[model samples]
Target: MSALLDQPLLWLVVTLGAYRLGLWLRDRTGAHPLAQPVLVAIVLVATLVVLTDVDYASYADDTALITFVLGPATVALAVPLHRQLARLRGFVLPLLTAVTAGAVVSVTAAVGLVRLLGGDELLARSMAPKATTTPVAIAVSDTLGGLPPLTAAVTITAGILGAVAGPSVLSLLRIHDHRARGLAVGSASHGIGTGRMIVDHPVEGAFSGLAMGLTALATSLVAPLLVALML
Candidate 1:
């Protein structure tokens, strides 16, 4: 059992299986608000690791394979974006304006919440880019002298929450425009929310891709500057 668990592939299998189980449960529960698959998967995997006495480092080493796919997945979003180039070109100014606002707001809100909750500088910085996708958020956190692993975890949590509850919130606010909904979700929730928007509508998908890319670029630049200024 020990030898089998020691294999790198074991972690890959375990993580995937846990995620599938999480998804199954979420579906079974009719997509309950608190039954977020990623969140559930994390709990499941963490419990398993604790029960088996497996080190986080060993688990992370194998999970890097899954993390590495995020880059390609982000790039794949460009296909729908390309098809909607003309529409994007039309509203460039408003999109840029909104993306800029979202970037700054995301950073401030996350950092502010952490500080309000009595977190220190490192924790604040780690949460600073929570609205961005995992890859970019990790990089931004590292640049801001934050813990990359912690940032990755926070970013994923934010994404999962946004993907699950964002639409309802938007509907409550009477935001029915597909483009507006997509941009809002993508800017604040990153890739996961963007993926959901893509399944809902093409315009939403395009705007989401645009918002995600632009917000990532903006956040990458803005976060470091903000941290430096505050420091």
Candidate 2:
């Protein structure tokens, strides 16, 4: 049984099954923000792996194919951009400015506070790229001399929090524009937030996807520069 569970494809099967279960649970709850599919899936998967006595290293290695797919998945977002090119171009300057400013501020505040709190340089850099998506954050963290795994974890947390709270905050601020909402969520939360925005409205989804792409590009170029300037 243990050997069977340790098969190369076992983790992939378990992952897809757990995610489906998570999606079902989320739908049953009317897709409450707190019941995020990935979050639910993570909990279920973690619990099952512990019960089955599978080591984290083996599980991670088996599931690493999903990371490779993120590249093609991200590239697919360009479809929406192509369809909405005219509208997207009109907002390019403003959106670029927003993403750039947000990236700088996010890195600055995170690194500054961590250093102020007497945290080590490693800890500061780990948290610096929290606002970016997992892949981008991992790359930025590596360039900044931080741990890729730790940056991924922190980036996930930031995405989850942005997805869960972003809409409510936008409502509180009376920012009802779809473009504004999408940009805010994507710039702050990354792909996870964009997923949540898609379920709300098509326009919001498009803008959110654009914001995510722009944010990834801008942050990739800016993160190392920001680190050099500050450190």
Candidate 3:
């Protein structure tokens, strides 16, 4: 068993297997929100990690290939966006405004809520980038003198919440446009929400991809200034 723990391939297989189980569970549950594949996989993997006392760094290294795929996947989103370029052209200004406003609101609301709830400044800083993609959020948290791991956890949580509840909330508000739904989820939840949007519709996927990238850039620029103000 100890020897298995030392084998990087063991962890790689475990990660994939866990995700496959998540998919099976999702299918069995009729694609219920609580059974979201990524969320389920996260829970399973984390539980295993805790139970087996796996070193996080080793586990991450073992799963490096999975992480590497995110780059090409993100770039591939542009293909769909390109197909819808003419339609997207008319919304450029509005999209930009939405991204900027979302960035400001995300940072301030996360930090403010944390502080208001009696969390420390460090925690507030970590939460500041919770609305961005995991990589961007981690980077921003480090720059703000917060814990990268905490920021990553918070970012993923935010994404999962958005992916789970975003559509329902949009429906409640009578937002039926795919573009608007995509932009709203992508800006608020980043990659995970974009992934959910892509699975729902191609047009929504394209807009979500665009919004995810723009939100990351906007947050990267906006978070520093906002944190400075808080300090």
Model 2: per-residue Cα lDDT at residue 136: 86
Tens digit of lDDT per residue, candidate 3, span 47-79?
999999988999999999999998898888889
The per-model lDDT (C-alpha) reads 0.85, 0.85, 0.89
Q: Judged by lDDT against the true structure, how good is candidate 2?
A: 0.85
RMSD, every candidate, angstroms: 2.4, 1.7, 1.5
Model 3 regions more than 4 Å off: none
Per-residue lDDT of 30-137 in model 1, one digit per residue for the tens?
Answer: 776566667777888989899999988888898998888867888999999888787765688888999999998888877778878888999998988888878889
Clash pairs for candidate 1: none
Number of the predicted model whose lDDT against the real structure is largest: 3
TM-score of each: 0.87, 0.92, 0.94
Poorest lDDT segment (10 consecutive residues) of candidate 3:
29-38
Q: Relative to the unseen true structure, what is the C-alpha lDDT of residue 43 in candidate 3, on a scale of 0 to 100?
A: 91
- List candidate 1 stretches off by more than 4 Å: 22-36
Error at 140, model 1, angstroms: 1.6
* Two-way lDDT contest, 1 vs 3, winner: 3
Model 2 regions lying over 4 Å from their true place: none
